[model samples]
Target: MPHLTCTEACGPDELQRLLRPRSDVVVEEPDHSTPEDAPPDAPAPEAAFRAVDGPFHHYRRTVHVLERHDEECLVRQRISYRLSVPVWGWFITPLANRELRRPRHDGTQPFWAPAERLDPRAGQVLGVLCLLSVVAGYLGTLLSQTITFAFDEFDAGLATQGNTLAAVRVGVLIALALVVLADRRGRR
Candidate 1:
């Protein structure tokens, strides 16, 4: 027979064991505590929140676990009663069931991308490319101008004179603005 123990302050392993066999577990209320500041309308957090943390099958009510470590966990759940359609890659993209930050209706498990800290390589690359593009555009403008002046009116150089470093500068600025906006959106 398997037995269980709930220490005064239970750890993750202890909690896992408790959840293993039982679908639901109620934590005993802590006694002898007075609140320094308590909301009149809101119930005590311990009493109000029934935290169900384990290997969960997602559903309408389930929140997806965004980040999880040995002890710390970050979960994201859909905002109920709001069906928002997020746009991705220049098109309206509907998220798959796995992409949703919620539990599935079925009791099947789904694979997830484990959370790892982001590195700075992507930022470094984008900065380098922007610089290079600016330089290239400047050089192209100077070349096109010189060619137009030296060549005949009907020459190809005359046609490409509109393509200048100024154009490149405009394009680069637009791209940078887009990148910054995207980053801001991600942070929120």
Candidate 2:
């Protein structure tokens, strides 16, 4: 299995066409974009995982083996490049050693395959329960303070107690918003 890295101009279909004729040719897609292929006009292979944080695009490109021999397999090799467009071409290979290092696949399944049923409501319920717990905790704290503290002291502590409750409410609001957004996206 010969691992070959081609330019971004080479599409998967084109690469497959190039390798399909040959029995031993193995093609591995690159992980990142290059200088010549920066403009987004060039054809880039679809990646499995993608994330955008700050100014940089963080992601991993997964190239599944289309064809392989019994003993050897094809793997995609990607070179990460930071694109400033039409300017400097900075090649960034942050985790070269770690990226190259792959775990050995023994090709055997574990004894117990515990399948999980994902209830859609479970996550939302958990988030709501957590929010309720936080609110309950704040209420409990306030109730405890009322039992021990003088009336004037309790009045002074009310603002501080309210702040804590507000923080929890804000957190719950964010969680609920996230859940609602996720639910909408899932429906789409």
Evaluate candidate 2 by giving its C-alpha RMSD to the native, one decimal: 14.0
Could you give candidate 1's per-residue lDDT for residues 1-188 as a string of tens digits? Answer: 11111123344564333222222211112223433444576333221122233211111221234445777544333211111211121121122222332223333333321132112333234345656778888876676567556556556563454565467668779988998999899899
- Screening candidate 2 with a backbone cut-off below 3 angstroms (N, C-alpha, C), the clashing residue pairs are 28-76, 30-78, 31-78
Residues 78-104, candidate 2, lDDT per residue (tens digit)?
423222111111221222223222311
- Compared with the true structure, all predictions reach lDDT values of 0.36, 0.39
Top candidate, metric lDDT: 2
Q: List candidate 1 stretches off by more than 4 Å.
A: 1-160, 163-170
Candidate 2 segments exceeding 4 Å error: 1-63, 74-116, 150-188
